[model samples]
Target: MYSQEETLRSTIDKSLKVIRLYDWLLNLYVLDFFVDNHWTKLPLSWQECFQNITPQDLGNILSEVPTKHVLPLSFISLIKAVKSLSLPRDKISNKNKIGLLLSEDICNGHPRLKNLFLKHVKLKKRHEICLMSKVVSGVAVESKCDAVVDFGSGLGHLVRVLAYNNNLYAAGIECQSQLTEEARSVQLVHAYRAALERILVDYDPKLKHAPVRNIKHSDTMTFQQYSTQALSRLNIPLPACFARGEADLRQWRRVVTLYTLRLALAPLVETVILLDRVLYILEHGLSCEIHPVFDPKLSPRNHIIVGKRL
Candidate 1:
């Protein structure tokens, strides 16, 4: 019999296989971490080269067959080492921007389908959204709630995944224009493609049915419309009300000042969600659990937060 941890990992791995990009990303994430810790040291010239490349150019480079499989390991190690060095946040940000550009470039150089696959793939980070989603779903299943609301949704990825997987009526509140725009773009691309596919593909009893419906793309709408549209598209009755607003961390008694600086746009959220900070949620009438979804060891903040309305 497999341990719960092994079972969870197996489930995630199987799910990941369905999405080529996610599969590659998962492998890359592990490989990158391994290389960063144990592989060849990256030179200053290579670091400069990485900083200079754009996403499209990086995509092109990734498209070509690598001379050695071990090379990625060395490159990833260099990135980690650089991050470890005493550098200002701005410098790190610049480096990351270059890395993203490289990633995007590599993605673009791939086939259209592969590009689409990679588009949804994201680096594994300390995200509570997945755990929060599961908790919300479980609570809803028990209490028969109408919808789940995610506040301060960055790129709306969590909401998207929840609605897609659980057929839940969900809404996201996003304050950042850039992240909102990106989320909207992703939503449109996937929604439009799914709509087109449904129109073209005839129903077949032999094929497995797709679980998620096309999410309606709207800008700055009331929570009601968002929930209604998501439910209506899936031919489900609308929930009475959807969840709204971002999670609050202002109520936390003890929190780091650096957290405020990090979450300038959404300051009162760190203590409410961060792993080291999640105790506050429990104090504020929420339950906490560390579930296996992503690699937790990669970051201390990867667990999810589940709160029931008191």
Candidate 2:
């Protein structure tokens, strides 16, 4: 078994390598994809690699192992390198994989109290709270934490489950008044349809139509049209770049490709953030371990840094 110091140091080293190698992708602003001329920033080889790529082609690149996808040799190599450098995200052990907790778990299985706390919670948030609460419960039990303090607790979801279901002393701090009051609240679809729609409408005046107030009928219209209408309702104007033809088909595709590349590095980026916390705790002579307590698909930011004072 590796010592805590050894594990953290090694993980930090790999994370830094990925960060340094793809600093450009990490730094690029997704919101400024059109304005920044981001395609010019990509390596010429990488630009050539993804220039003629299709939607399905980019999907294959995003997978864990691209067995059937045909990509340039360099792109394949980059993917492999990234995969090799990323920390393993699987559950640490069966010991850490505790069952999820709910109101029923703490409310003595009372049916009335079962889902009251979960009233406004979505499936993803429900899954996360159940899993993470159990993990935090375990860590608190192990360390005998005086009281668990949750930062950015927004609506106190996790802490609620932790304190009630797990019977641990917990407190939550939230800075956002909106979230404090009610702690609330993807996809590459058809070549950035919404972005394309905004640009196309400006590019061709004939497509323009009055904005609709309700987007509930989004299914009836193209995403671009729906988004344009929605934005119009809010009196938000499409960027001038779209009207100028600055962000055209080629730029859209490049932006998607660049975004996908950045997605590939997301795990490494998260690791760097989580491990930096671990390293800081270690510096202070506290024990720290990152637990992959939540499902990655359900909760992309699944790693939890648990610290214990030595």
Candidate 3:
């Protein structure tokens, strides 16, 4: 057992590595970053936010916006503020460091699931989860919750990790029909494959999922036999990663929104989206936390807000 102050000190130190950039904080308010040309992969939700912004609204915001000035947080200042804050001892204890490091038990468990699940998840998507896992696992453990709800869980990437890897009851709430359906399909395939392989191979049962050998399966003497048996028994459907069907590029663009391409080029909406998501979690009256997942220098999307039911 670690003292709360020890955990707080360590987490603050890790977050501080990039917290001084205070400039990154300021960028959150800059509107041009969202409209800038460098952003190429604007997410579906971002597209919605963009569409929601009226021309008149944008004009007024742009008119008053400075060429460059955004502000959010400072680690040192945070420490000073914490010292000055006169909150009750109970409340202070309740507010554990949001970014506690991942314990080996959760972070390193189910190595097979980590690798197998990533097969269908893209590289960039996997990278995001790697950063997310640190905070997610820490929050889940600290809050001691079995259920996790990912807000704006695009394509269910984080959901996949939580459910299959951590053996948690995780669900993603994505607004886009295409993205939600796609994630559901992918999860079904990944789960079926993992179930099949685990039963056939001798693995560490101490991990999250123990093998249920009695479940029906084909002989696994060879890959061909296993594959056939899996198909016949599981009848699993692969995700878009497995087969590329003819797609109307134009329609798909409209589905994801071509605005994504332009949005990525500028990436100004990122800070707004980040702050909005964090606030959205806090407002729900759950035990919520805000923590930096990785070094911001590596990926500005390193911070996250995790909420656990009280």
Candidate 4:
């Protein structure tokens, strides 16, 4: 129920908290805790510091991605906020939300797009794509741009909603070719299924009661062929760039260049990015709004940075 604006503001505050915590922890001789050194091998003070990590404290920090073996950003904030006189040195927190968007909110969006979501996506994915679509759509509307490029369009969820639901001309740029192909498959499947439904709806009344065993079986066999021929079978474009290679993440300066070249003169052109694993990116002459994008209880990493090219 949190407004996107509020989410932006609160999450920005939280992101700063995380940045502060990281800075604070670095000077505490906690760098040993960051490296390969074992707990027993660390200095006694370090051991005591970690030993203070209680079950409750652990719970608080665990809210970040545990699977990555990295400390949760919120936990970082928690550590800084609770720094003791017994141990000193540190500062920073860039509140970032961490979780997939949910389904119920998105499925109720565009009806046909919802069908694609329901048919092709998992629950977590459904939510993520749906929520992402909303965020991008809002920005796209304000930015007045028809083209959308999703940086790491994993599995094409965000791209799916963007292209089909939001009616944006979307292109998903992914590093992995296999995922790009898989996303194309999902897109083809939806198109094929939609084609079949149209046929069913147009079926003659005289044949309406005819056995659907063939129809059902045909659906099963269609995917087995998995042909590029599917393109000829329908007008629905596969929302992907099949042969597109990995992007040069090392060259971040291009983001600013892009804004200067295209977005600078526009009143509301914007730069939007997932502020995880990297700090927020900004172009000069632009304004940013940071928001807590998700229900915090579900994901502490829910902060988003929406920077308008003013």
Winning model by lDDT: 2
Error of 1 at 175 (Å): 0.5
Residue 94 error for model 4, in Å?
Answer: 22
**Stretches of model 4 off by over 4 angstroms after superposition:** 1-37, 41-115, 180-283
24-110: candidate 4 lDDT, tens digit per residue: 333322111212222344335434444434434444433332442344444354444433111111111232123334324443356
| lDDT, each prediction | 0.39, 0.66, 0.44, 0.42
Question: What shift in Å separates residue 266 of candidate 4 from its native position after superposition?
Answer: 36
lDDT of 3 by residue, 88-165 (tens): 112121333323323323233677655555567654455557557645767778878788888898767678777766
Candidate order (lDDT): 2, 3, 4, 1
**Cα-based TM-score, every candidate:** 0.29, 0.73, 0.33, 0.41
lDDT of 1 by residue, 1-310 (tens): 9844444344444333333322222232211221132111324444444433444444444434343323345445433332333111122222123233223333224455444333554554213444445556787887678688888876666676467656788899987777534444334222222222222222332322333444555556544454455435454333421221111122111112112212221211222224333444545665544433333333333334455555
Off by over 4 Å in 2: 1-3, 65-70, 96-106, 180-247
Residue 286 accuracy (lDDT) in model 4: 55
What's the C-alpha lDDT at position 65 in model 1?
Answer: 35
Candidate 1 Cα outliers beyond 4 Å, as residue runs:
1-120, 123-132, 180-293
Report how far off residue 242 is in candidate 4 (Å): 50
Query: Candidate 2: worst 10 consecutive residues by lDDT?
Result: 182-191
In angstroms, how far off is 87's CA in candidate 2?
A: 2.0
User: What lDDT does candidate 1 reach at residue 165?
Assistant: 52
- The per-prediction tally of clashing pairs is 11, 0, 15, 36
Give residue 58's error in model 3 in angstroms. Answer: 26
Q: Which window of 10 residues has the lowest lDDT sum in candidate 4?
A: 84-93
Residue 109 C-alpha lDDT in model 3: 67
